[model samples]
Target: MEQDVFRLHYEATQARVEEALREQIGRMGRYADLREAMEYSLMAGGKRIRPVLVLESCRMCGGDPETALPFACAVEMIHTYSLIHDDLPAMDDDELRRGRPTNHMVYGEATAILAGDGLLTAAFQALTQADLTAQQRVDAVACLSLAAGPEGMVGGQAMDMAGEGRSLTRSELEQLQSLKTGALIAAAAELGCIAAGGSPEQREAVRRYAQCLGRAFQVQDDILDVTSTDEELGKPTGSDREKEKNTFVSLLGLERSRELVEELTAQAVAALDGFSSRDFLVWLANTLAQRTK
Candidate 1:
């Protein structure tokens, strides 16, 4: 029953984010092909976890979730752009995503790259267009830039690429995942706080929650790669092993990795200790800890 309620909330949030994404894309006028390519991947079905975090965090901070919608859409756009680039032949070389052909596979490589570029730039445009106070907009944009810039997500990707075919210590692997995957997620939570006019303390607490959640998310992904099927994952399973990447499961063994996920989930929920109206966020953390995809 609890799981059903969580799923209902999840689906509702996903629908809201999807609708806003379509509306945001509809605002673009030039480069019809580029728009199509961008939409190809942007509209690809997946859990809109980051945007949901934005909304939920806003609500947790006693703000209207609707006020955060535009920024939420921007976060999703940034995330989708990352996915588009990560699937390029020069990156992970993936041909499928979200159970369909990847952007590059459907639109060709060059266009796909541009599509990613368009999404990334348009994210800031969306931010500018949002109905937000100047301070809120500035804070949100700064949070995103810091997270997505070279020292954050891009840096993490570089580390991941460099670590390929090499042994990495557990800390090294954690750092890599924190930068590559956790950064944007942390940004999502922080942007939510900014959109809500949260104070420094509130933002700091939520950031900690999101950081733990993000790490747990990657740990779950590592576990899924070893345990899930291609059909379930919507991409080839065991690719981590095939690519010779060091993962939590590889380093800690499956049982210990599962334990780590649980511990991280607990830590994430604990970070919400003093906040009220955090039930949804707590459930979200737990659900993500056990996500199958």
Candidate 2:
């Protein structure tokens, strides 16, 4: 697998997910203003890595991309909602995201909050309408619910807020991020496996892979917060320091953080060995480790 080939595939997958998101959003609800707010944030794009992981993992496990499309879009919707809420004045209080004004800045705080709620509910609706067995749908809903609910990302956010202005131990920081970041990523891979009707062994391997990749991604982001420009990050740099929150680069030195990234990347790639076709996932893990933004 050439880097060029992987790049092409990655772009194509991102496009596919966005297209599905746009199409599905049109059908989400009839309230024009609400839909406008929802569309604003949902279409404000990023790498679409989460949805891409869902589709690719499904394909890798011998499922049709179409079969995974709705769920992938659902995951993207959930992610976008989280971002909207995370940027509110009560949260990170940032005014910029993805090189544009934050949702609250553009749409007012009330609409921004409703927009996030709308997207969250719409995501669950998409899940209910997905083409899966009754049992599969039940399990998928349950898994994603746990990942997005107070038990996972929300819980981690609570810990983050509580730990603000205080130094967290390395283990405590890892525990927080594992839920805040790693949980949904792990769910993305597991959902793909479920979508494909993959074996239990395959599910475990991909989940392990996603967990490491998610951690590496966050660690690199923490590193970037210190080293990259605001232009590169599309938001304020040194935010971790401003908030006095513990990060990989904060808990561990820059040199030590880089070492951990290397370790995590290796572990992530190793977890994919069981799959016969894993070049993209491998390349993806390594590329994320070295990303500038």
Query: Candidate 2 has which clashing residue pairs, if any?
Result: none
Candidate with maximal lDDT: 1
lDDT for 70 in candidate 1 is 89
Tens digits of lDDT, candidate 2, 167-253: 889999999999999999999988888888888999999999999999999999999999999998898899889888799998889
lDDT values, one for every candidate:
0.91, 0.90
In model 1, residue pairs whose N, Cα or C atoms come closer than 3 Å (at least 3 residues apart or on different chains), thus clashing, are: none
What is the overall TM-score of model 2 with all chains considered together? 0.98
Candidate 1 vs. true structure, TM-score: 0.98
Against the hidden true structure, what lDDT does model 2 obtain?
0.90
